[model samples]
Target chain A: METLKINYKNLYFPPGGILMWIIIFLELITFGMALVVFAMYGSEEPEIFHQSRLQLNSTFGAINTVFLLTSGFFMANAVVEFKAKNVKKSSFYFKLTMLGGLLFLILKSVEYYHKIDSGITLETNTFFAFYWLLTGFHLIHVIMGLVILIWTNNGMMKKNSDTEVVDVEACAAFWHMCDLIWLLLFPVLYLIF
Target chain B: MKKTLLFNYGLLILLTISTAVISNFVAIKSLAIGLIMGLSALKFMLVSFEFMELKKANLFWKVSLIFVLFLIVLSVVFISN
Candidate 1:
């Protein structure tokens, strides 16, 4: 009997079924709870809460949104480059995507500085608490995406170039998911109740 | 491939801009939110199918992603309602 070994490049399709759904469902659940808590037990002072929301630099949120979208665009381009077998080009896009992530982090840090200087912390009120919690979760995902990009780019530059493409795509998939989640967060946290 | 790719990306940008604009300008915030969420869902599906190459993927993988997304979105709707 002859055993045919599939190429390492095609080893694992992204995971499916219970585990995958469970992870996404978990995120949805957390977001739902955030919404419900925000509605029911959120700050008693609607005026203050709304004012706090207005105080939020929508400009910064909008800027971060653009950065994440640009990063997602580059990641999508990297997938194209990977499929074209242009490893160098793929790495270039990955680096650009990571740079976008870094820029978003820096802008967020600056926003945090202004927020803290204005005497608003997570402990200030429910509005601030939710703001920090939701944005902080997003920041963590950006950081995770950055780490994935670095690892995948390093592998692409080394001996395991071909095998790295799938993981790279997976990282892009996750980053897109992060961006999608922030799409909802932006309106809910910034514009709506 | 290039045509569909451009179409999807173009639609994605349009949807993003529309979501922001509608949510910001409309007085009916909840309805605006629903629209934004809908548009974002559409954008997510396009990205997953077109950009991620899931259209040519195996059935199990495709269905799993679709199912997962549906469930997640359903949960959000259910909880929000």
Candidate 2:
């Protein structure tokens, strides 16, 4: 019998799984660098950072948490429905998840408006610096997730055969990752003070 | 399936309340943070395993993904201290 040959492309990197792992690893590196910066500056001027952390509105963080978690849940449901081939329900939850992301951005905007109006600029101190850096980074991920959701929704609307289960899974994972990062960040920033 | 779904949502609501309560009680500081984060981790696991159906995923993907996640969290805790 002829020796079996493995196709490199088919061997691994099943599109969705590979993409998910890549994103997770990237986030890990980002968080690592952030921690290193925190360690260095945190050693030099602990109080300033600690004090700035106190300025974070736990209420806003909590609301965003609820929205993102809800979004993640809906996205996961959409994935399940997609697997079951229940197109209508999948579309419904996809839209719901997008709505959740939209609400999160709006709440964030309102929170930012209040902060800027109150003149709590990043120049306030080291704490504000980290506060802006960390939350701002997380906000970027939130926006990215929203864009993915929109694209997925558009694909579904257009009746594309690209199989959106991967999109649903990736978006849900990203949203969940965002929430997980904040789970640590909130307590570190708000509750710690 | 419906029951599991209901239970999942209920647990989520309970976890939410626990997190909120823990946040407000800052006197405990580290303890409160640990407790809330701990609960959130539990919530995330539930969503991943139950809601996302990772339980049915292939062994390699399931174990490796979880391992990576644990490693990430462990690194964070270590670096943080």
Candidate 3:
């Protein structure tokens, strides 16, 4: 009897799925362009950007970095636990992952509130405009990511769990995209000026 | 796989902390900026390869995504300088 072998080399199914990877690439490109433009503008008005960056709380940015990275770690472990069919372990890890995300969001919201209280807005300056738009957009992605994680976790809790590996992979991929985007944004927006 | 995941997470956390601290305490402004960007790229690659499982992905996707990062980083660094 002859057996069939699926070659992933020529196939488009990367880690999560082709469709998901496509979205990742597109989103990266969009943000990548914006970041480059931001850098260019910073060069033009280095003082304004530097002063604005100093106003940004680097401590908040650093703590958020730890939160997101920790979350991503928990998320990867959840996927591992799920793949082993250890639903209980997976559920625990999933909760931890969500907690990390929740903490990040709460912190970010507090930072945003402080910014608003101080009258920083898109119209404040070029750097502030990019800051509000880029970080705000990334925050929205994190919210969507949390929604997806909750949905998948709920699926896993059902009597007959319907969440597939691909589904979880897709979810993790989206969540990590949030992390990845934040990595780029953190250094440039908060650190580099 | 478990060991690999743990190791990746460890390196990621280490890198993140170092980047933040170095940028905070480093005396040279230009040096700090360069180091931060470089470390950020390391974080990007770690998440993509380990967490996102791009190491298991096809070469095309892996290479393309990396190239994209390189371009973005290069442009930002050049203009910032």
Quick one: best TM-score, which candidate?
3
What digit string (tens of lDDT, one per residue) describes model 3 on residues B1-81? 399988988999899889978887998877888888899999999999989888888899889989999898888888898
DockQ, candidate 1, vs. native dimer: 0.31
lDDT of 3 by residue, A30-68 (tens): 999999999999999999999999999999999999999
Tens digit of per-residue lDDT, candidate 1, span A39-133 = 44433466766777888987788778778777777788887777677888888988888888899999999999999998989998788898999
**Candidate 3 clashing pairs, residues 3+ apart or interchain:** none
Ranking by DockQ: 3, 1, 2
Q: Mind giving the per-residue lDDT tens digits that candidate 2 earns over A72-128?
A: 777767766766777778889888888988998899888878878888877877767
Which candidate do you rate higher for TM-score, 2 or 3? 3
Query: By descending lDDT, how would the candidates be arranged?
Result: 3, 1, 2
Candidate order (TM-score) = 3, 2, 1
Off by over 4 Å in 2: A1-15, A32-46, B1-6, B58-81
Span of 10 residues, lowest total lDDT, candidate 1 chain A: A1-10
Write down the TM-score for model 1.
0.79
Taking all chains together, each candidate's TM-score versus the true structure is 0.79, 0.80, 0.95
Fnat, model by model in order, equals 0.12, 0.15, 0.78
Q: Mind giving the per-residue lDDT tens digits that candidate 1 earns over B2-43?
A: 566667767777777787688678787557656765776676
Superposed Cα deviation of residue B27, candidate 2 (Å): 2.5
